[model samples]
Every structure is written in structure tokens, then in C-alpha cells.
Target: MELKKSTQKRHQLLNAALDVFCLYGFTGASLDDIAKRSDMHKSNIFYYFSNKEALYIEVLTSVLQKWLESMQMLNVDEDPEEMLTKYIESKLEFSRLNPKASKLFALEIIQGAPYIQTILKGSIKKHFRGKVKVIAQWQTQGKIAADISPELFIMNLWSITQSYADFETQFEVLIGKTLRNRSFYQTAMKNNLQLLLHGALVK
Candidate 1:
């Protein structure tokens, strides 16, 4: 289905905002930059979003929403090992395709997430709590390691998957090659992540 004109415009602004925020951090990113990237007039941006902060929050929410959707792919009824491996694959794929979103999110958290603080404390917290419940249930069913803390376990997964996007430059420089290399990603990143997750979680 085609998006409404307004919705398409909003998406354009949001995507541009994501790129700007990823490149320039919260304090440095400007409405002008977002406007230029969106190819919309600055006033048009304000028409869609009340202010820069509002636009920033919306971008953060959009990115976080995507992250949550990836996690939502997990099914408690499925074999836990398969579910976990699929989850890691989905996350890494998202990072590969949308590194800008990951960078924008990392910048927000690193700067203490001022604009997104309310969201972090509210919906984001609730989402993680629900996932934690699922993980705990899996542990009780002997599907996952009972010895691991669900919160830290999830954190570890995020760290590993997000690092691929967030630290792409470091990896490229260290390995003397871009992550665009399929074989390298399979051997050095994705496969290793799946192996480690299965090793740690499967019971």
C-alpha cells in the first residue's frame, strides 16, 4: 500500500534525522542539518515536529521501536536454542542494514539519553521486563542456563550484536578489511556469536 503524503514526508524527515543524529550526537545535531538531509525546509520540519528535541525523541523512538520488533521475533513456544540463534541472526542482520540507527541509539545512551529518558524508563523498560520473563521461563523449562542473569544475558546479546554496527570502523581497521566481506562476517562475527550464544544458553 502507498503511504499517505504526510506519512511519507514524516518518514523522510525521520530517516534524515537518524543519519544526522548518528553523525553528530544530540548536542551537535541541528535542525538545519536534518532539514538539509531531508530536503525539506526548516520550517517544514517544525511543521512536522514541534522542535529539534521533539524530532530527536521521535527518531530515537523509531530506532528503539525497530530494535524491539527484532526482539519480538522470538517465540517462547519454539525450541529455545533455535529461537536464540535466529534472534542473534536477525539482530546482526538489522545492524548490518541499519548501522546509522545503531549509531544514533549508541549516541543517545552514551550522552545519558536526556531526550529519551522518559521512554527508557517507561516503554523500553517494560519491553525488556517482558523479555526477561520469557528468558526466565525458558531457564525454568531447562531450555536456557539457569546460572545466567536474564538482564545481563540480554545485555550481552545487545552488546555483541550492536557492536557490529557501532564498531564497524574499529573492526575494519583492526582486521584491515571492511565488514562488507561476507566470508569474514560469517566466520568472524555471526557464526562466532551464534556459537557463543548456543554454548552459553543451551541446556
Candidate 2:
């Protein structure tokens, strides 16, 4: 239908925008670059977005939504080890598959998140607090260490997993292999799970 095609075209635009933004950062990226990347005329971008800022916000919002969805796997009722394992794997998988998107997000935050600060403080904060409450519930259930700070634990997990994307060049230099390799990915998942779970899981 027309709606389906419209949605598809919107997604194509967002995908192209993501690549351009990641390569050039927000200030450096231009609508012409995104249009060229999407193989559409620059004027066509206005059909879906009001302006360059609007498109950039949409692209950033989409990436953040995907990142938050990865954490939805966590459940207080599930075994802590199993849930944490799945969470770590999901995050790492996202980093591996969408490294550029991950780096773009990191760059946004590093630059003080000028465009998405409202979203970060509103929906993103609420979502993060909900997950922290889940972690606290796990601790109360004696699933993880009571002494572990839920906020800090979540922050650390995010930093470590996202580092693989935001610092891919450094990782490549040190590991001598990209995460594209199955072996490297497995090693990353295993080590991340171990490093994280070892400290938090109740003995």
C-alpha cells in the first residue's frame, strides 16, 4: 500500500542519515550528503522531515530506541545470571551489527547531547530508572549482591559494551581482529558476561 511504501522510504532516509551523521557528526553532516547517500534529491528529504535538525533528531531517536530495546530483556523474575547474560549478549550483538550508529550516539553524548537533551532527560531517564528498579528488585530477591549499586552497575555495563563500538579503532588495534569475526565476537560476549556477572551475582 501507499503507507507501507511511505514507511519504507522514511526508513531508507533515516538509514542514510545515520551513515552520514556517523561519518561527519551532527554539525558536519548536511542534507545533501544524506540525500546523495539515499540516492534521492535533497528536496525530497523535506517530505519526511521539516529540516536538517528534525531529521538528525529522528535518526538519533531511532538509534536510542533500539539501544533501550536491548535492555528490555532484563526481568526481575528471571534468574539474574541468565538475564544479565542475555542483556550483555544483546548489547554486544547490537554494537557489532550497528557500530556506526553506536559511535554516532556516543559522539552526540560526548558533545553534551544538544539536540536530544530533552528526550534524554524525559523518556530516556524514565526508561533507565525503570531498569534500575528491576536491578534493585533483583538485589532485594538476593539474586545479585545487595551491596552493588544498581545505577553504577547499569552504567558500567553500558560503558563496557558500548566501548566496543565507540572505540572500535582502539579495539581493532589491540585485538588485531574486528568483531566481525565469529571467534572475536564469542570471546567478547564470554569475557563481558564473565567480567560483569562475576562482580554482581550473589555468591
lDDT of 2 by residue, 76-192 (tens): 777888888888888998899999999999999999999999999998998899999999999888888998899999999999998988999998898787688889999988899
For all predicted structures, in order, the TM-scores are 0.91, 0.96
For this target, which candidate reaches the highest lDDT against the unseen true structure? Answer: 2
Report the lDDT of model 2 for residue 132: 96
List residue ranges in candidate 1 displaced over 4 A.
1-3
lDDT of each residue in 77-129, candidate 1, tens digit only: 77777777778887888888888898888888888888888888998898899
Q: Tell how far residue 112 is off in model 2, in angstroms.
A: 0.4
lDDT of 2 at 102: 91
Model 2 ranges off by over 4 Å: none
Itemize residue pairs with steric clashes in candidate 1: none
What clash count goes with each model?
Answer: 0, 0
lDDT on C-alpha atoms for all candidate structures: 0.82, 0.91
Question: Whole-model lDDT, candidate 2?
Answer: 0.91
